[model samples]
Every structure is written in structure tokens, then in C-alpha cells.
Target: MVPHQCLGSVWSRRNRPGNEHVAPTVRATIAQFNVVASCIITTCLGDPSMTAQDRAVVVGHWIRVAKACQILGNYSSLRAILEALQSVSIHCLQRTWDNVSRKSF
Candidate 1:
């Protein structure tokens, strides 16, 4: 999905009310999850004017971060990073992808 659409869906769910049955901790956890996911997508695609090489560098940085998250057993952040990288907005940047090093993948 496109980054903006994904973020909008998450935002809607996060703000939806009338779920008193759900524990406060659970609600907070879900909110945190959504926020992390949204942030990851935004950070990856927020700057439209960035050069292809700069975008590639950002992509590489995220890849390394995902690897660290995996090693540390931070599945939530890892999933968010993966989703952001795979999102249509970032995936369609052919020039950026071309500039990304093989090691990043």
C-alpha cells in the first residue's frame, strides 16, 4: 500500500473510541505499534526532493536498523521497517533502488 494510506488507516484505528472493554495497556501498546509503523514510513518517504542517492542512503540506514532490530528481538520495529521498505511509495523509486548497494538488501 501507499505510505499515506497505510498511515491514515493506522491513525483512524488509533483514535477510534468506545472500546472500554479493552485494557488500557493493550490500547496503549496498539497505539505505540501504529505510531512506530507510521513513523517508519514517513521517515523513509517524507522528503520528496531528496536525490536518488540520498534516498538510497536512507534505505540502507533503515536496512541496517532492521537487522539490529532482528538481532535484538525487536519484532515490532523490524516489521515496521520491513513494511516501510516494501510500501509502494518507496518500492516504486526505481532510481533510488538502483543506487542502493547490494549489501543493504
Candidate 2:
């Protein structure tokens, strides 16, 4: 096991913007993150009666979210985006500062 943190290592995508690859990566990251976050956050915010398996599922789900957020963007409002990201519990998905996600698109 890579400690669940290695998956969040930022992938350096070069020339992606010029090739229109950036948009899809961003969109995919957001979409995937949203989906995984929904599952994990829902179970997490739900009853304390959740089983150990449910908690494990949430932990794995958050790892997916972290990996998605690891896909970086080179837009102008990076600072604002980062701040906004901090507002969400998804920030814990990465378990480290391995990703620099934006709050604002």
C-alpha cells in the first residue's frame, strides 16, 4: 500500500492546454471528485451507527477524490480556487498537500 497518499502525487501534464487536454482533465477531476465525495461525505455525515466496512469504503472513496484533485490546472485564479477548496472537507481527501486544487473554476 502506498499509504493512500502516493495516489495524490501531482501529474505534470505538459502541452495539454495547447492540445485541449486540460479541460477534460479538469472536468474529469471535478466530476470524479464530486462523485466520490458524495459517497464518502454522505456516509461520514450520516449516523454514527455506520459499520466499520462503511468507514473503510469512505476512506477509499476519499482517496479517489484526492487523486482527482491531484490533476492540476494552470488558470489565473489559482489562489481563490485553493481557498475555496479549503472550504470543503474534500481537502482531507488527499491527506497531504500533494495537490493544489482551485475552489473557483
| lDDT per model vs. reference | 0.77, 0.45
Candidate 1 versus the native: TM-score? 0.73
Q: Candidate 2's residue-wise lDDT over 1-105, tens digit each?
A: 123222333234423466444345555555655664454555554666755555445545444454555565533233333433454654554532333223311
Tell me which residue pairs clash in candidate 1. none
lDDT of 1 by residue, 4-41 (tens): 43354444564458735434455565677778777867
Model 2's TM-score against the true structure: 0.29
Q: Which ten residues in a row have the lowest lDDT in candidate 2?
A: 1-10
Give the runs in model 2 whose Cα sits over 4 Å from its true position.
1-42, 72-105
In order of appearance, the predictions have TM-scores of 0.73, 0.29
